[model samples]
Target: MPDNSSYLVVPSSVLWLLGFAVVSISILIIATMVLRARRLRSGMHAAGATEPTGSLLPEFEKNGQSAAASLVQWSPETLRHILAKELPDAQVIVVSNREPYIHNRKGDDIQLVVPASGLVSALEPITRACAGTWIAYGGGSADRLVVDENDRVEVPPDSPSYTLRRVWLSEEEQQGYYLGFANEGLWPLCHIAFTRPIFRASDWESYEAVNRKFADTVVAEARNERPIVLVQDYHFALLPRMIRERLPEAIIITFWHIPWPNSEVFSICPWREKILEGLLGSSIVGFHTQFHCNNFIDSVDRFLESRIEREDSAISYGGQISLVHAYPISIEWPPAHLGKLPDVAQCRRRIREKFGLAEDVKLCVGVERLDYTKGILDRFDALDELLKLHPEWIGKVALLQIAAPSRGTLPAYQQLYEECLHRADDINQRYGREGYTPVLMVTEHYSQVQVYEIYRAADVCMVTSLHDGMNLVAKEFVAARDDEQGVLLLSMFAGASKELLEALIVNPYDAATMGDALLQALTMSQEEQRQRMQRMREIVRDNNVYRWAGSMLLDAARLRKRVAVDRAVGAAPAAPGNVISLLDRKRVAAL
Candidate 1:
């Protein structure tokens, strides 16, 4: 009876105290979980570690994991071992239009700037890994200040490894080959971006001269040794053939960085046949997506008399076969602590202060080169529509458009730049407040650290490329979001959209739809943002620039083996006294 009375007499105050304790413990558990997740996220970013999301190439899998480890996790030594195993005794030589490190005169001292390019990010590691040579156009003002008599220097200056062999291009050569032929001709011709390609005979001649120059340099570097020559992008469409002519024993692999239009569209190029013949000199030719590969193959089939092996995706002509393949390029994941650096907060603060943005105002950032293909004008249109539809976000959201000037000499690019400024001005005039402009357009070139700071500070990153090979800015933004916060509004036209499915994909042409998407991105909950960003970060971290390079090299190696076998079976004649081919034959025989 005493125990029963004691139980029944339990005080309401005691019950309230117990309930409070239970509630506090629950909150503590949730908070701990949230903190633990954040710590794990930070650690993964720092380590460039990612949970495997299947494999990009199932054939290159060992125990359900890709042989090519995440760039963050894989060392240069690891990559070297892989290259040795894949193509033993073969030296790698990379050819590209853009140099990895450009030396410029910063006041009196020589300053090296790494240009913004997916090619540099992808191939530079391969060169470092294998101690290979990188042949590129020396367009920097002070390029000669660093190079030796051989036009060669070890890079990057901070931690030098591998050789950088620069091919000097005169201002006129650069203007005609790069700005005229590459940008005005091959660029627009391949992109399907509605920009009419301007093909000039002088431009074509300059392009040819540049290719020959690069070929001569590669031949000198190889010097009686048959090396693996990787020709990059449209700037060197004729480079593969030119190199092949010089070193017939060389294993040439050309990777076209832009999209290949349908045969109908590509027929507009007066030099289409020559371009096809030049590309066909490669043992392998790669594109960013399968659609591009198919387009290239179809174009060759339609325009040329080459025997198309549809099953193998190979074009047979000139006593050689060139295989067409897809290799989607990506960005190098920044050091895990990049966003967590002590200076990042200061950088973010500086950017905010520079733009006069308030603490509560959310940032929507767009980083792009001022070019017609980048859809800078379309992005502004979407922003204008966004403010009109959602009046509530008028002062709450601000767009920071960082338009890096590109090809300023080109009339189309110049017009695009002027149009971008005009559109941004019009938007600001309509929706801007006294202290807040809806769009803060920054046209100056920003250092990598500055760009990373901008990426880290943004609540949303808009990649509205009208058409692109693989818009790497989308991947870069994903890599910079170490806090697992931010939304990605990626253009459906970009090749990255195929891989980054978690992003809010929209057509840059649809302003109303994009405006609604902007609203959705702005209003997306913290949990939703974390989920989307986490998935994208994992994808980008796993399929990084190293993986892209490794995958391409692996395919090239496979094609090399196949070609050698085909030659052995009398598909083509092996060059007499070609020790390289002999070694390859012996290796194939042993296998």
Candidate 2:
């Protein structure tokens, strides 16, 4: 007992030395922690882990406001750089129903054809920029002939910037999955069109089978396990989850290119749960508008047993979280097909001559697929009413209705075409003189350059969809107008309407109002046209297709880097915030 007391009472010099040593150790630990924190911050910044400011718009974007000039105007070069930084070794793999270029048989020689599809228009630039692989359905007659053993063909025929992998589907599979389920079921179900969605057991089976097949193809085509897969459109709603189940590490960005109806409307689908689950399998689910994003979240909430985080715009389901965001789709700025486009004046002159019209005749154009959802009949009705209300426009204006026939086998579309033709005939008969046709229908598919030429030539471009995602035709009309001369009559229901506010927004359902809008467009002054077109051009230029792709990829990049950082620092996602406790709180409290 005496020895213990003596030991406890140390010498004064020894006590001072012990105290100095303890302080030195404490200082060393603090210095080490400070240095480590600095290093951690630097590493995080280098890894592209931005501070959580809770904003979706990147630094480069600023809503096309004149006060806020874009730091980076998105281009092919910028997109390539973004891909290099964000994705590094991983290539972008696009899963789509339509190919950028299709091989068709013309006699014995195989000819390449670019499909006249909005989906193609939106995605081709990204594929070309990244030199990435496009996985699409091989519907072409000679698609099998052009591809190598891997069913891969270098596209754009002449330049060959990217490879297109063809996935073959049998007739039965195509009919059931594409025509029956996708076109008939999902298209009508999603669109505000009056047609009813036809869901068959056979079609659902084929849809599932096709999605599974595409997923398997995607997995095989992936350069790495964690490839950036962009699942495109309603054609492949089940694809994201199918890809997810196979390649758990893959980052899937599923873009719903069509308008996502409200939850009440979405409940019309019989297999709504499956669709919601499939979409939630994605890392990010992109829509054309915030309204659509809300609709999607509402749908998921209504149908699924998922954790909804509205503040974060995220859904946690099946041990994973999916972020739902609106990335308004757009056409390419200085579109890829602008290489050989004639000057605007020349385009107008040529188009007037092509249509056998006088220079004074106002050229109004409508470019879309011949689908009921496009409101082609409504456009014709509007024109009919326009001529009736103002008979002066009867012979003075021409609506060059250029429509590529789509889903022709469907009764709704076939009926729409007939109705459109009859309506066009009635308008032409009632209005047209010897050489003036008010409604001229071009039913054949036109190439991108051809469509651009049309867009450039028009005095007015009518994108009167009853319900639409971001109508690229509206953007295309804006993008094509270097002269800033045309008027864009966009439907209020179109997602582009919300962005292109300068456009004469009209409800496609209201033919009388649209007729008046058409009249107003025809009567709009050149100065007013310039102001509106200039503003729209700015919007389209600032928010082009590359920006759309870049924005989503940037988000993906942040998410990827965060996951990597968490894993590297042994940060458990399930743990509380600030998981890495370099200084033990319990020890500090005891001290």
Count steric clashes of candidate 2: 0
lDDT (Cα, tens digit) per residue for candidate 1, span 415-434: 88888888889989988878
Predicted structure 2, TM vs. truth: 0.86
Quote the positional error of residue 22 for candidate 1 in Å. Answer: 69
- lDDT tens per residue, model 2, 1-591: 355654666789999999999999999999999899766644332222222213321222335432221446888898889788766887789999888887889999988888878888889988999888999999889889988999998888878899899999999999999999998899999888889999999999999999999999998998777888999999888998888888777878999999899999888888999999888889889887767888999999999987776645677777777878777778888876767897999988988888898988998899988988888888988888888888877678989999898888889888988988898898888888898888999899998889999999999999999888877888888988999898999998888887788999999999999999999999999999999999888878877888788877877775666557556877653111121221122134448
Off by over 4 Å in 1: 1-77, 334-340, 343-347, 560-591
User: Each model's number of backbone clashes?
Assistant: 2, 0
Model 2: CA > 4 A from native? 1-70, 572-591
Q: How much is the lDDT of residue 316 in candidate 1? A: 67
- Measured against the true structure, the TM-scores of the candidates, in listed sequence, are 0.83, 0.86
Query: What is the C-alpha RMSD, rounded to one decimal, of candidate 1?
Result: 15.6
Judged by TM-score, which candidate is best?
A: 2
The local distance difference test score of each candidate is 0.79, 0.82
